[model samples]
Target: MPKQPYRFSYLLLTRLLLLWVSATFPAQAQSVYTQETALARDTVPSFKRHLPWLAAGAATVYVGGLVYLNHTWYEKEKTRFHWFNDSHEWKQLDKAGHFWGAFHESRLGADLLRKAGVSEKKAIWYGGALGFVLQTPIEYFDGRSPAYGASFTDIAANTAGSLAVIGQQLAWGELRVLPKYSFHRTPYAPLRPNVLGNGLSEEFLKDYNGHTYWLSVDLAKFLSPTSRFPKWLNPALGYGVEEMVFNDAAANRTLGLHAYRQYYLSVDLNWQAIHTRSKFLKSAFYVLSIFKFPAPALEYNGRQGWKMHGLYF
Candidate 1:
C-alpha cells in the first residue's frame, strides 16, 4: 500500500492490535481452569536458536517497508520538519482507532515474545509497548514529511494505548476488560465511494463511519466467585461516529450533513475463556478474538433516536 501521509501512517498499530487482541498476555497469566491449557501456554522453552533469524527477518522487512513508504512510494510529499497536529479528523474516529490499534498491538507483541520463549517482564516491556514503538517510527517519518506534521495527540494516544495493556497485564495478570472492534458497512460509503470505500481494501481503512471501538468487559474476572455469570461472556460498551463525509465541521457543512456520535451496549463473547484441546484452534481463536462476535445490541445516536440491533458486528 502507498502511504497517504496521515491516512495510512498508523495502520500498523492495527496490524499489531489484531495480532494480539485475539491472543492474550504472555507466559505469566495462570489459567483458572483446565490443565491442558497450562501445557499449551506458559510452557514455552527458550528459542535462542530462532531469535537471530527471527529478529533479523522482522527488522529487515519492517525497516525496509518504512524506507519504501517514506522515500519511495510517497516521494513527492517532500521531507521537512512540521509541528504538532491534533488531526481531529473523522470526528476523532481516527483517535479512537489509534487507541484501539495500540492497545491490541501491544498485547499481541507481548504474546509473540512469549511464544518465542521470552519471559513475562521482558515481553511486557517490549511487547506490551510495541504499539508505541510501531507508531513512533511512522511519526518520525511524518515529522519530516511536508505533507503532514508530527502529532503530539497521536503520540500521546499511542502511549496511552500501549500502557492500557501493559498496566493491566502487570497488575491483574490478565485483561479484565478487553478493547475490541466491530464494523458495519455505512450508507456514506455509497455517497462518496472514493472517500469512504473505493474498494474493499479502502473501506476498512478510510470508512470512519463504518468502524466501532468497544470496551468488552469480562465480568467473570471481576465478579464474585459465587456469581452465576458465565466465564465466556462479556458485556461491551462501544463508541462510533457518523455523517463525517468530511473530517472537519466546516467542510462537512458544505455537504449539509451533520456529524453525530454513537454509543452501543451489547453482549460479546470472550472466546479465550472457552477451553479446547487443539493448540492450533486456540491459537486461531486468539488471532480471531479481536473481533467482537455478532450479538444483540442497544444503541443511542447523538442525533437520531435510540435503536436496537438484533445482531450487530
Candidate 2:
C-alpha cells in the first residue's frame, strides 16, 4: 500500500520534468515547420516579390542584343554625313546666347523625362528648364573641341527644342497621363539655312520666316549587373523631320510661300556609368544613340546633324 503512494509521486515527477524541458527550449516546437520547409514543402508566397525583377531581366537580355546589332550599323557610316553647325555654338559669358542654348536642350530634356517615367507637367517644364541650364557647359566644351567650335545657332535650337517639348506636353492632356502613346505625335520642326533665299540665293529674296522640328522615339531595356555599373545601356533611335517655310518677296502675293521637307534619323547609346541611380546622371546620359541615318532629301544640305559617340552617366 505504501508503494502505491510512491508510484503516484514518481508519475507526478515525470510530468514536471517534461514541462520543464519544453519550457527550456521553445524552438523545438517550431522545428516541425522548419523541417517541412527544408524538405521543399513550403507553401509561403515569398517568391512573388521578385517576379517583376525577373521579367525585367529577361527583357533586358533580349533587347540588349537587338540594340547591339543596331549600334554596329550606326558606327559604320556615321562620319560621312556629318554637319558643321558652328552658327548655334556660343560662349558662356554671353547671357543672351546661353539662354538660347539652354532653351533648345530643355526641349529635348522634356522628351527625355517623358520617356524616363516623369509626369507630363513636371517632365516638360523640368526638362526644358534643365536643358537650358545644363547645356551651357556642353557649348563651352564645344569651343574647346578641336574639330567643332561654338555657335549661337545651336543654343537657339536647344531652347526652341525645349519649348516645343514643354508646349506639347501642356497642349496634350493624355500625354501627361500616358507617356508612351502621348509622345507618339510625331514632333516636327523646319530647319532653314540662315541664308536669305531658298536654294536660289541668286534671285531677289526677302527676310524669310522658317522653322525646323525634330522627332525622336526613346526605348529602354535594363540589363543584369555585370561589373561595377548596372549591366544595361539604353539605346534610342530617333527619326527627325525637317520642314522649311519661306516667303518669296519677288513674286508679290501670287507666289507667297516656298516650302521644303527633309528627313533625318539618329541613334544614341546611353549608359549610367557613374552615379547611375542619381537623378542628375539619369538625366544626363540616359540615351546612348547619336548617329544620324542618311536620307537622300537631306543630302542637298550636304551635312549631317551631331552624332552621339559616347557618354558617361
Candidate 1 regions exceeding 4 Å error are: 1-6, 9-34, 41-43, 46-48, 72-74
Highest-lDDT candidate: 1
Local accuracy of candidate 2 as per-residue lDDT tens digits, 239-275: 2222222222233234343333233333322232233
**Model 1, TM vs. native:** 0.87
TM-score to native of every candidate shown = 0.87, 0.25
For model 1, the local distance difference test gives 0.71
Report residue 9 deviation for candidate 1 (angstroms). Answer: 7.2
Positional deviation of residue 118's Cα in model 1 after best superposition, in angstroms: 3.1
Candidate 2, overall lDDT?
0.32
Give stretches of model 2 more than 4 Å off.
Answer: 1-85, 88-123, 142-149, 174-313
Clashing pairs in 1: 16-105, 17-104, 17-105, 20-108, 22-286
Worst 10 residues of 1 by lDDT: 24-33
